[model samples]
Target: MGCTGPLAELGGGETVRRAMDVNFLGMLRLVRAVTPSMAERRSGCVVNVGSVVGTAATPWAGVYCASKAAIHAATDALRLELAPFGVHVVKVVPGRVKSGIGRANTAQIAGGHGGKPREWGMYREFTAAIEERARASQGAGATEASALARHVAERVMRPRPPREIVYGSLTALFAVLAASPVWARDAFFARRFGLNRKL
Candidate 1:
């Protein structure tokens, strides 16, 4: 529900701050507030559900990706830092989720696409179709949050647990790409977004 649309001309510093506050700082503040209690117990687990955007910065969604990327990095470090104290930090990253949240965010961005009133006129056809396609594409299940909860629960009970764990198809695919060379990963997403420049 708190996603952005591109039409807000939301490119200024204030907009950036608003996004960072909600997407990055909001989670961070929550964790910070909770950490003291977790530390006091000397045994706690924190699982942060992030997005593929966090891992892979997508075009036209730079701010979203940036926030996500920060979370990923923070989670990774926090996982290690928390380990010795019996606190576990796990990050679950998913992709292309047919979520109302995703739809809302995409629509938000699409609404702001052209950047200005005059620019909107130019972007009408493209933005309308993008919105339509976005609406049409939601509702498939690429991930199961309940299953993710089970996995996290299992991790919590384990005497020895992983520092970081990803969930579902997006995580799996990203892992495959990660193991491969950079060029291959580049080709993969390039093909996906039709951004491959084969001139």
Candidate 2:
């Protein structure tokens, strides 16, 4: 449900559309299928897993960030909408839990280059940075998947589950950045993602 590439590249629109379809629409489809039965029973919980990137935009992974942001916004709306039906909707914003997503994304990006990484014409100089961004979430400091699962399960099982669960590494930092002024946030990310220099 993620893609890594410069938004200015050719065919970027298709990339964004694909990310949205898979990440956002895919969730919507599942929610639609289950919400009806839950509404009828007047009891059920829907847990949506979002990401820290959704809170603050980052370079290279704009499509992924946008899709997650859609999830976050939709989850918020669904919470209020489903409240009347006794169906609880929880938004889980995970920072970086250990997963194979990084490798998978890397492979996808490299698939068109004869099993090697491919760089867009205009972004050739930024290839390494782009690859780094693709693997950023799989760092050693990332949260353990099992731990995140346990925490989420315990909380969701509570009689009164929280409306949102923000967990994992960099979640707090991303939350703060999300609240910061646009200019400041932009400066921080620009420097962090190697966008501070002119190409």
Question: What is the TM-score of each predicted model, taking all chains together?
Answer: 0.71, 0.94
lDDT, candidate 1, 1-199, per-residue tens: 2433243444655656777788888888989988888988898878776776676554345576678888888898888887777788878676655457555655455444655322234334345433443343244655565676687678756766666666665666666765778788778765654446543
**When superposed on Cα atoms, how far off is each prediction in RMSD?**
4.6, 1.7
Q: Give a tens-digit lDDT track for model 2, residues 1-199.
A: 7788887783556657778899999999999999999999999999999899998989989888888999999999999999999999999999999998898778868874466556689888888888889899999899999999999999999988999999998898998999999999999988988989996
* Candidate 2 residue runs with Cα over 4 Å from true position: 10-15, 112-117
Where in model 1 is the C-alpha error above 4 Å? 1-15, 110-141, 157-159, 197-199
CA lDDT for candidate 2: 0.90
lDDT of 1: 0.63
